[model samples]
Target: MVDPAQILASIKTHPPSCLQATKCSSHYFSVLSGSAKHYMMFSEKICWIGFCLVGSLTHVFATRYESGVLELGIHSLVPGHSITVDDDFVICDVDIEVSFSHGYSSPGDLDVGITFDADSPVTTGLARNHSCGLFGPVHARFDDSSSNTLAVNSNTCVSDGSDVKPDGDLSLFNGHSSQGSWTLSFNPSRGYIQLQQWAVILTPCDDGAGTGDPHFKTWAGKWYDFHGACDLVFLSNPSFAHGTGLDIHIRTKARYQYSFIESAAVRIGEDILEVGEYGGYLVNGISNADLEKLDKYTVTHEKINSKQDVFTIELGAGKQIVVQSFKDLVSVKTVGASLEEYGGSMGLLGEFGSGKWLSRNGTVMSDAIAFGNEWQVLEVEPKLFQTNQFPQHPVQCTMPSTSNVGRRRLGESIAEASAEKVCGHWGDLKDQCVYDVMATGDLELAQAGAF
Candidate 1:
């Protein structure tokens, strides 16, 4: 029963002293001044004890063995310097060794808890009130503890009971980078617990190069729909081992008729194969759920064998697009039947004919036929769209529109009532009304006061 708030409050009020003990012996003496004694104990059984006026009774334990007494030295704890882990490393497992003084009257008198990064607490044998009949060292291991064999010593007592078990698995840190500051906190609820040593093991994964060529390069950029009719875009990036993966992001425009990515494939060197398919439908008008499907697209083959060149994309049925990449100038073509119809050559050495089509900069001579009318490349910072960026249907106010003088309340102007009627039919152009009203300065403040 360890309360994190109470432990943190106690540590703030009574900070333990940092002291060095020069002698090692079977008997140790400590002089505590106040009711609450705060002691920082190190591995060598040495402790720097301090006192505070917290009015809470803390039990002190002293144990003596026939062979020898454990020696611990208390050192000043530094905030950031206490522990340092490599930035690129990934934690695989953790092993901690602790020793508790055997001066408790009963088994439940001692409780020891340890937490990493303020996560859930992992307890020792003392947490289950394991009888301290014979105790010198208790080893608690995370992940797998079957490999660790408890060492038995005549002078030192070891816990071999089944009351204590490992707390968490290494999967908690899987896929998470090991660069942040990891806080290892120790909290003892009932009795005094001494930490001997702890170790964290790391296993690194190959990020870019493993079996593939280290110098191999892949294309990574954003491709927008030629016209903004359909709120959909293609993002191509290099997966592990320099493989190409295409992610389709769709923003449905209408309700009931949801947009779905039935299948997706990339044409590489005249060969066409089904790359992957994300068979899920995204509901229109729900921006959050639809945006989440952007990253969930399936990439059948991560590594695509192709140079930095122009590639044709075959998206499901009746839809095709071309991506032209030269250095950093990434261009996309969408308003054509196929790569042959668009007159675009494939691979690194090929180029597309600049027919009666718009260029990458979105300068259009004629409107795109593949996408519906009213299509333009609204360029912003190249990033994912937010919830507010999605088109929202105009809300229709269902309040009664009454023009009678008796029904109209006091201070309600006729123009205000007219604007309300206009808003109900504004539909999708409701957002444009606000801008038009501001630009033209047509709606007088006195007349459009409610608007």
Candidate 2:
């Protein structure tokens, strides 16, 4: 029921926020294709590496999204491209594109949905269907305008990882398919690593009824699926424990039924664009599927002509999968300044365990959500910061700074469009743990540098 396009559109034409995530996405440890959307760190990719968890902090621009409660901001995080956070639910905001494809296929034909589970674990989890993380697009073979030829009965979901292609049909387990090929491309703007693996018609032997030929199938039907996209970023070092772990078996276990992809990178000559942030975690998931291979390491790296290595797959029915597991201890944090006051009053800003609820300097404030449920940190408009134009911190004037000063409410209707806005309380502040949406249900209420 989630609309991936709506999510992407929000990122393309929406405002920014002043909220923060307290913890990484929750990790649903296991190995299987997922429904998309796990908590931030526990989202997906890192789940493939050891514990894909980051320690100390999980720094985002510090924004939160809620239905009628808050708006998710999508900015030109990358040049030439705009991105949005998918907030079909709590936590995650993986990027996704719709009615979009690799000129070969699309995923819109399938009932795929993107979700936001900002908090997942680094270890075990369940299979995800029609969900997104970081950057995503549910791929299926129901060709719209993009596909020029009818290739086969298959799904072609794609996203961030641009250059996609299966190594080949031959591997350690099942024999290679006689039909179907792979493709690739890149969408640097959305942090998308576009990849497309193409094949046509089911090769099922029908209980060994006859030789499997995609051209003429007897009992099975032909499906032309397209929309393979999005990238699953794996840690540079999987052996080294970090973030949440992903079980690869579930992916290959189902074989042909699904495809599990690891991380990929984009290189404009020498500059490398990592799909996910430098230090993010992957949520736990089942790599459950029939994969003739598992490719690890720099699927795409600085090396221009470097060919990726796909892992071996062992398939067939009644095959129990023993997967590689992981856990995420990764944490993200935001960088900010503090807000001193005109009075140079008692220290400004509150202190949390490792984070701060207080403003950093004369015009800056910071907020964090800790490691559980989401909490909004209201950020006032920069125009509000203009009030801070007062040559000092806590500006306490018997008179309002100016008529414009009143427009600086963190959650004010006028202030929701700026990049650097205020959130939460400013200077001297006190609050309680929040279990529900704010009275206004608007994230702007959490603005910084406010009294």
Candidate 3:
């Protein structure tokens, strides 16, 4: 049972910034030209998958995975970002069917599919045996991802998946390639059988171009939409979709169709009931308790004052100030005149305040004190997001850019925020402590995010 929410989170942490990364969903959504409705419709591919049936999830990941946190402020994953998840339609195991249309609406150009090397694995890129197959240079014939011969007349075959080479006598052909053969091979060990793997063929026949449609390179790489696998074909249909911002906003039961895309309905033993109809957008069988704490995190910072009170601090690349009020306290005041008044260092409010203040090297705090009675202090410092960059905001408003011109043009004041996370060997501890404490232990705000 694949977890839909987890899949989204994984995608969010690494939101395909470059063309190569965006190849999966980006190239996948290439809608064919609207005018080519007559001549030739692209060949539809179909895949048959069972059990691994994950129900539709109503969410997508908040960020794309990256080695480090992005310097740019990340968008949140709240409501209004909902996608759809479908229910089971099968009896025993779950099946999936996905189809593709013309390749038009490209947010940007891509540089992949130009070659088929493991160097730039597109999509999830996790498929183990994704190497030269079906007709690249490493096969019994010429096996390489860059050969355009197959785009013409070609065909080939495979026998096994053993991590072994083909009969050495003909394994590496320098000039020979095919129209279709083993274009792709997962594991060379699993012997080839008609029922085992899906064989896709891409035959090129120019149908001509459309008036205003955009041009995109045919993704020479292979990707799978759950179970919707078939004799995948890239219909050089001539016409393609045309758009800068490609967003398909649909609701429940919004049926989508494509050719050759094999779709199968599936039902798990219990939890996962259906898949294939809608994109896996939601994760079923999750308890309300777990779901509540499933996402979201809290952060704690040391008070730069001496009296105990809640403080509002904005953490990010630019322009944000969140207010967090301490329980049972009202009168809030600033501890330092210029951020250097209270020992010039940051420590927590309650527990962190008790520690003795020490200055740099051998220096010590003469009258330095931690904690304070300040609850309304905004942390938009001047040195945030690099000492010279900033954004303007006026308190309320979610989508700032999506706001009215008046609100946006209010004034261009510099807003700065830098959130520092607590560090330690045990990563989970930092996550737990910050999340629990910032809950404010308030029942009314049980739903209010700690951030």
Candidate 4:
């Protein structure tokens, strides 16, 4: 009873979390057709490099598991100071550190051991056997991938290197479940060890979006198209990642019988960033230059060499909003954390994790037009625009009728086979690409659609 369209839409919208590793190399990697440089920032750790524009389109993607630090904040060495990592990442690597004040004895006297899932100590005698005979408060680190030379203090004892190995090498934990308790224990044989703090670094999670025309995809992987020419709330997540607030509003304009996103205004925390067609940008209704002085977010814009320009807004905690523009057409995308981690998010994007369309009143909508109209930005919401445009809040969404659809359709002149060939490998977006190409009579729209 499964629908093939829904299956393809899910796969096209939200590919499996790349942390699965196997699916990462075989699938989920996106290849953009251009020699021009393109960067796909998965997190601070992952990056994608674009290759040549001629012949074939190839992409070189390099990624590493993102790490998150959990503070232990213990003043003294306790038997079982631990933290739980509940994310679904594979436990590829682990590093434990302990900082202590200079007591009556040498820092080497403070012996430390760490265990995972109540198992044997991954490493022991971090400070006791290997402090490099250094004085002052010692910052000792025991890494799972260090040289396990415990007989005598090696030169590495002065650094992050470790003199002990886990019962099995750190690699043994690779592909193992990341959801477990990591316990840090110290020997009390040398009396109490005064410590400043202790902490562990573990891997984390990621998710986001990319949409254009009137075609939409929620952060939760739902896909649909709404040809509504009006301003609407694309996403409103007050609890977006680590308490960072985000509200994105998009304005769409009618083109023939179809519609395309014209502009987008994103409010992250106190600052507002607005991007529109033709590469113009505004921050809090001010000039784009003000984005450099943004307090909470890091903003960057690519050089505007072509018609379509890309801009990125970095919301702390590895979350970002990417805006792309191409002369009267614009698209918005999200990166880093998934919407599910935000507790709940609303607007035209629909429910956080449910693929069902949702109304602002919590009603499960049956169609895209109904769901999209419910999210129309109300006059009460903060107006991030410089000036009010026609058909503002209170006005119903201007739904475009498909009666004149044939006017934009591929006529008998351009065969369906020819249109498909010109659209290239757009995956599930090929149909939309073909339609946009015929509607505008511009082949470049196909590339812009990809952007």
Candidate 5:
């Protein structure tokens, strides 16, 4: 629903150096990373969002939400650079890349530090009064999941500094809100450092769903597959703005020992949009023609060679749902502001923001089956779908007895090498991609993994 032409026109008004702003499928994010000094904008994988050079000492990056890595560049470093993260996920890891035109005589000459909100500056591995020398561009990574220790590219750099706090690395900011301003600072005591470009790669806790075989990557970045055939609540926020928030439900059908999402119904306020296989959709039990007149939402249907139907449902304000369907396989994704609004929400998608699977009784359900079954649409809840599919509310959701155990091993039918080759691009979901391809014997399902 984002108009590329309008975005391009806005970019033209900026200085010529900030000409390129890469827009991805979910939303528009502008950042720079990888081995190059310039922004490397990937088509489908990562998004290089908005870029700007406001003043000599400060650079501001306004980034929209979505899964994947976001790298924002700052050419200068004196006071610091401020990054406003509008994404839903919490900051789990942060990678800082600093490039100087020349090397420093000693690492202690320049003190690099970062601060989130009012928190104290976290020096990590970059600090002053150290015995190491800054030879070239350096990459410092702070990951909370792996270790409290900060990982740096240079062997000469010390892990801890004179002023390093106990929680110096990203562990200090882990589980904190990803929103608000993050300031990066560099204080040099000696000669001009001449920093060419410095970038921050922010990796948030992402959420996604693979339709066939029905693997779900929760908001907390945990992967689990549920093979339940029934109409279930995918995500629900009953208290969103006076109980008119988003209510999404999905219809699933059994396929061998697995299940595929047959359709999805999304309700926002008074409007309901139901999408199914093969480019079929209905708005409030009526034809799709009414979507054009709606003010709160916009829907776009792109059918490639009349084979696959990709629907992008854009709810006003940065919230969106992208549904990609190839043949009968369907995958759905919620990105940007959509995720921002669903903090502490419920359903099969798990707890929004925190990713804790909680039942209606507010009990944390660790088991995927219990979590999935806990969200089955209750009989009293309003039904959004027009047709009453089998195994509806009031009926216990049907599940495969074996639950993917001893079920044809991955790469058993499909060549292991070929499956890996096809699914390698899936990143963290690589194994899920291979499993979906092998489970359904459909190569196109792996292609839809991009959703």
Candidate 6:
């Protein structure tokens, strides 16, 4: 939204000025041919105000001595500015005033006509002439009693001697190149017509001729999980708002029986969190309480390419979430989970159906006790996880206690057995041995064996 106050301020700071002007014969004159051209400049390709044309005239020289003329012609060299002949130029809101000084002797025989050049492009290459009767020659007698006003292209002329018409069109001169030539020509019969005065207004187009502010680009489509394991799909339509700002909407659904979970979470600039259906927990200076206070997250900036965007997720608190986006994937670097939170002997663990974990500093843990057996602890440098770089495999690690650990996949019972052994090392610690069995019915317990 544009601030009206700002617009007013801009107007006050830089007032509008005439970009160009050209005038010929403001005083009454008798001439065979006359034309005026003006050059204009628009600061912006798309300007608010273009230009205007103003002039006035009156018909004369049709008395007993001089003898009335056949017709008077007015033409505009510009594609759309002809009054005498019908052309591509569309003219409206005519307010020309006409009056008779002397009475007419033969109003019907002596016709007063207005015509334009037939070569105008607006005529579609066809020269069409249009004329209307001004007054009857019989009623030509008038001193100061005969005067009239008519709108441009108005079929109805004022019956009263004096009148004025206010509505009309002048679009031809409104929205062309900011810098161009505009010429208006007038020809009168026997030097009888007199131009009084005229004025017109024009407005520019909205798009600013490709230089408008608040430019936008949009992308809308569907994406699928890389593995195709769970029929997981994402329908997203994201619109760019004011360069860095963004509005994103994504609908995620799972078609298969597998539970879909996110390994990371998105943060909406210290104000919101758009948690998916499967709720998760925040970490690293962010707490569940902080997440509760936040409004539903609406994206302000979308991650594009590998460029990292760090957003403050807790207003004023300074907590941030770093994110990177790829073709169909997003990598969030916040300490958060995309699944149910569970406390373990090492730290906390949030598990996804893809056997991935969101853990604190590589301290391995699992939502299910038996599930621990499926993963092997690996010793690698502690670096940020790149969603596109790593292979789809299970991994676990115990930090501080050891710098390097090798991972080995084992069977369900083998994992249970190993867990029991590790629990035994704690020497009858109740919580150490008694693990939470949160697995669903289908994964409760199958044939327990060694891997």
Using TM-score as the measure, the top candidate is: 5
lDDT of 6 by residue, 288-373 (tens): 43434434332233322232222234323222333322222223322221111111111111212111222435433334322222
TM-score of each: 0.28, 0.15, 0.15, 0.53, 0.56, 0.19
Q: Local distance difference test, per candidate?
A: 0.28, 0.20, 0.19, 0.57, 0.59, 0.23
Q: Answer with 1 or 5, whichever has the higher TM-score.
A: 5
Question: How many clashes in each structure?
Answer: 7, 171, 75, 1, 9, 36
Q: What value does the lDDT take at residue 397 in candidate 6?
A: 18
**Which 10 successive residues of model 4 have the least lDDT summed?**
47-56
lDDT of 4 by residue, 67-91 (tens): 6632212233344545555544433
lDDT of 2 at 14: 51
Instruction: List model 1 lDDT by residue over 327-402, tens digit each.
Output: 2112233422222222222111111221212333334334332321222112441222323233322321111223
Output candidate 5 Cα RMSD.
14.1
What 10-residue stretch in candidate 5 is worst by lDDT?
36-45
Give the Å error, residue 429, model 3.
14
Q: Which scores better on TM-score, 1 or 4?
A: 4
Tell how far residue 315 is off in model 3, in angstroms.
16
Span of ten consecutive residues with least summed lDDT in model 3? 209-218
Give the lDDT of residue 226 in candidate 2: 12
Q: Show the lowest summed lDDT stretch of 10 residues, model 6.
A: 208-217
**Model 2 lDDT tens row, 1-451:** 3343454455347533323232222221211123332221122111111111121123222234567554333322211111122322111111222222222223222222222112321111111121223333334332112322222234333343332222121111111211221111122222122221211111211110000000011111111111111111111111211322211100001112211111222121222222211222121222223222223222211211112111111222221111111111011111111111001111111221111123323232332212100111113211111012221212221112234333434333333323123333332222210100121233432331110
lDDT of 3: 0.19
